[model samples]
Target chain A: MIRADETESTIVPRIEVGERLEAGFEWFEDTFDSAINWVGSTVAYISDGLAEILAIPDALILTVILAAIAWLVRNWKLALGTVGLMLFIITVDQWNEALETLALVAVAAAIALIIAIPLGVLAAKSQIASRIIRPVMDLMQTMPALVWLIPALAMFSLGMTAGIFATLIFALPPGVRFTELAIRQVDAEVVEAGHAFGSTPAQILFRVQLPLAAKTIMAGVNQVIMLALSMAVFAGFVGAGGLGTEVVRAISQLNLALGFDAGLSVVMLAIYLDRVTAGIGGGEGVLAKLLRRRKSAPVQTEETAEDKAATGSPTT
Target chain B: MTDTASNNVAPAVSVQNAYKAFGRRPQTIVKRLKEGATRDELKSQGMAAVIDASFDVAPGEIFVVMGLSGSGKSTLIRTLNGIQPPTDGTVKIFGQDITNVSPRQLRSIRREKIAMVFQHFALMPHRTVGQNAAYALEVRGISRSDREKKAEEALNMVGLAGYGGSFPHELSGGMRQRVGLARALAAETDLMLMDEAFSALDPLIRKEMQDQLLELQQQLGKTIVFITHDLNEAMRLGNRIAMMRDGRIVQIGTTEQILNDPANDYVAQFIQEVDRTRVLTAGEIMEPPVAVLGAGQGPRAAHRLMREHQTSALCVVDQTRHLQGVVYEDDVAAAVAAGAEGLTGLLRQMPATLPGTLLAELIGAASQHAAGLAVVDDHGRLHGVIPRVTLLNALADTSAEGAVRTILEEAPA
Candidate 1:
């Protein structure tokens, strides 16, 4: 069997005909090289420095953390499952590393949401704006995610910033596209209803359209979070850290156990977030149903309360 | 919202030659556009949904617009509230031309002075009942406290009290409709426009809502522009009814005038479906008694009364001048079987109609009440019989010339 060094040689492409032609491939080389340097620096900085996260919306932040615990482990059986999973991950002694991985994911998702929502609302409002923006959204959506990191590294230099930049691009399309589509799906009757109430376009957008489209928008958020998390792990190739780093690190050392544990942790986090998001999305569904029934709830409430609590996303 | 904008010369509400259209084909509108079609012209070629229509709505009156489906009733009503704009005309509310009002001004107008109720009840699915009801108030910047109070009051008014926290999906169709009405009522607007609002409800529920609307109207005296196709509903609710067809008003008049005296064939035919007897009251048709007959007289004796008075049937009365059974010729025959006194068996009589009863119901009740003849009334007492001939003659006098009594009364073959 080939040694680790020999494997690296096989994976890396060989030099071609001339320096100029080589330079023709220079973009890739430069991108990778910078990405390596960027990751190295970010690791160096994070190892020795603190990562500063801007203030989390207190309501959403606490709610999310509480939701993670409640949704996955609210019951004793679920609690045991979660505890077992956590012990398995920590026993591999990648807990600190997993925390770093989670941070990167959280950052990417937050950035994607920040960028996508405004763009979605803008697309919903103006045909001209949509015309200018839609083609770019198409490109972002169609292009493979890894391909973006090359440019991201070229532009931002290889580090947490570049890694996040790449992850953002990868996760962004779903949220923005879904948001625009969902907003468009808002009932024309609803729009008319808002108008009848004397709602201005701005008011209708904020009060009527967005809230009505909440579940759809939240679904978009789910896709974005999942995609960002997936992309963040892959980004470790450019020296972006987290469970992905451990995967690559273990692969480098030919340590299958470490690689397996890291991959397992990522899957766990993914499952947790997916459940929470899905739960919240389901919660909004309940909210909509409950809203419809509010008039008669006085008579029927005993029958519906349990359903509401189960489906209601206190976190959302 | 600029609802606070002053209008010194506003004419309440006015529509001038308004037209609304949609393209039958995409290219048609584009072709028109190329052919120098302006916004109005471009819009006109499309579906011409509402056509060159003009009407004025006075303040504090219930004005009903009646039409069959696709007759521009909904479109016209929607345009009044600024949800849809007219293609080639002006809509002025309280003197300001809203045809080109900025979205801000339009919102303000809708917020402060105009409210609309939709047939589907378009309540926001995401909001709780209180939240939905208070939506407009919030849009207009009302504080939470005041808005909640107003929403509560509105919900109570619509019979949705204590349901402020529930979501729409939890409500039934009727409850949802009430929530919608509550939402509009919460807006505190002066002008209320409804588009087939009660049509989606069941018959009994619809009747209840209609009664509620009347009560609300009576209490508030708000100016209302209501759209409906059911002639009965229009008659019941409208102070004035505008009959529309193919995008134009065919006729407009008071319920009494429209029912008793239709303006044209279209209006008359429209009236034909209505229970005309219900529309006209005894007070309106009452004139001096044309003839008199004794109590318990039969239609057989009505020949003398008809000949004496030269009238079809005598208005029968009892001893105390109260209405009693009509003394008609048929009653006379009946009395003969009962051993009538002398040559005239007039004591066995009956008249068509009772006091204070809807004459429209009389025909159907006639058989149940048993007697081809009818009884009239002075008050609650039995009047006299309108004999088969006299009744036919009276109807003949009132019916239009050559307008045969359409065997409108028939079970389908």
Candidate 2:
């Protein structure tokens, strides 16, 4: 067999992008030490504050408050279901870890929304900004959840703060994408009507576009919550304490019952959080319809574009 | 123009050489970098929607811009309130040049001076009818109580009372349009732009709405710029109608002038299918009666008046020119020959027509009566006469001269 020439069959060309990134990161760490320190401390302060508040509350008391909120925001059935899930976590002896995870997810998602929504609005306002952001978001969403922990650990130091920072990056794309979509989906005619009546640009955005897009933005918020929950367990490897750490401990000791109970508690908590958020998001739509019924209802059950056309618009 | 000036009031709206092009405006730097880019070269890059449209609308006048789709009529109307700014030229509303105003000033103008009623109503789906009507007032930062009171008053004005609590989705098509009208009324702007505002309703309802608008115009005296593709509607509502074609105003004149003297073949073709009866008022088609024989005039004078007016009959009127009856040429000649000084025997009974009577309603009376119909105003004063030939020509869709000659020959004239 003839040997291929050295230049001919090199399967892939070597690119020094990874090496450049590593060198850049090293340079950043050396030069931006004070900035990094400030950010890391801020993250620590917020995460610690949240964790302390969550941990101080008695499990039963916290559960009752959460259940009450669910009942008020949604309905009684969702409230009872939440109570059951909280009791299950307490019985499994994982209530403390569950609360810790809840604090981490809450802080992460809140930061993500605060940052993401405005960024999405900016992106939606400008095509060039949107073009630049879309690819970066795709990369963030597609990268393995664990891959983010490496940089996050280096930047913030390994702790719950680092875990939240990682979760924030992981969950941010959905919030941004949905917010941009919601703003763009507001009817152009409605916006024009607002302008025709002499509404300022800010007024149009706040009074018209924001209200019309509320349901869609809520859906985005729900997505962020779900993503944060999913990332919490993966964050445990970097010393982020939660049910994730408990599962990791069980795995190392090969204690089957402890791992099973811990995993079951995570599942219960995830299910409960998901249902409550979904109810809050979706229940308003049904409730609004029910309220409309008490007043004079539309001729059609659904006011579709076709139905509007059927009424014979003057534009015809 | 001088008549309006003498009254010390400017036209409600004045547009001068307004041109609008649709497409990305070429970058200024790009144009500078390129050598010798001609107007044609630049124009090729963008579609021109309006071309040098100029008109003046007097105060309290319903000026209509009439055209089919793609004729730039809608674009021209939108340019009035700075919704779509003209590429070149000026639009002044009550003598204030809106084109050069800052955004803040434009907003003030929109809020305080101009109101628009859309074809689709453009009512806010989430708001109650009253709230939708008050939207313009709310934007102007009026107090809520005042806005609500004004909105209710407007709804009542448009005959949409008791609909304040209902949403747009819950209302019928006609009611929704009424709400749209009420919204504009609530704005209380002196200038209103109605873009195909009544075209959406059923035919019967559309007629009713048109009548309502005319009634409102009498009460409010708003200077309205009405847009429509329907020539009949343009004829009915417009104090002066502007005909647009391919982004240019082909002609602007009164309904009678447009119907009798079309500017070109395009305008002629546009008005061809329009039902003349529906469009022509009796006042428009009526002519000076063959003769108005005063009650004091003898049969000889009646015969002389008939000959002078080139008619075979004469109308007998009182001293106030109020129409009493008509006398045929033969009867007048016979009365004169029989030496009868009193004209009672010469007077013939005939149907009387009103100045507001449509040419359609006068056609039958004109064709059946030998002496034709007398056109009178509400006070019974003789406005003019609608003879058989004149009524026939108005009703006919053929060439005007040919129709009159054919009718005159076909009749006993």
Query: Each model's TM-score, in the order given?
Result: 0.71, 0.82
Query: What tens digits encode model 1's per-residue C-alpha lDDT throughout B242-314?
Result: 8888666777777767766677777778777776554443333334454666555545455666677665335
Regions more than 4 Å wrong, model 2: A1-13, A23-64, A80-93, A247-316, B1-9, B26-44, B288-382, B398-413
Instruction: Give lDDT tens digits, candidate 1, residues A1-316.
Output: 7543344465675444455545665766566876666654664455324333312334334334434464442333443455555565567776666666667777778778988988998888888888988898888877887888876666556556667778888899888888899899999887888888877778888888888888899899999999988988878877777787888898899998888889998887677677657656666334344433432355334334333323322211
* CAPRI class assigned to model 2: incorrect
Task: Put down candidate 2 lDDT per residue, A1-316, tens digits, no spaces.
Answer: 4333333447855566666888998899879989988878887788778888887778899999988877766777878988998999999899988888888888899999999898888788889999999999999999999989988888877788888888999999999999999989887767766777778888777777776777788889899998998898888877788887888888889999989888898898888777777776664534444444433433323233123323322210
Clashing pairs in 2: none
Calculate the i-RMS of every candidate, to one decimal place.
6.3, 10.8
Candidate 1 at residue A2, lDDT? 53
Q: How much RMSD separates candidate 1 from the native structure?
A: 10.1
lDDT of 2 by residue, B7-39 (tens): 456789999988777767734322421354433
The lDDT of each candidate is 0.70, 0.81
Mark the regions of model 1 whose C-alpha exceeds 4 Å error after superposition: A1-68, A72-81, A251-255, A284-296, A299-316, B1-12, B23-45, B253-413
What does DockQ come to for candidate 1?
Answer: 0.29
Query: TM-score, B chain, candidate 1?
Result: 0.66
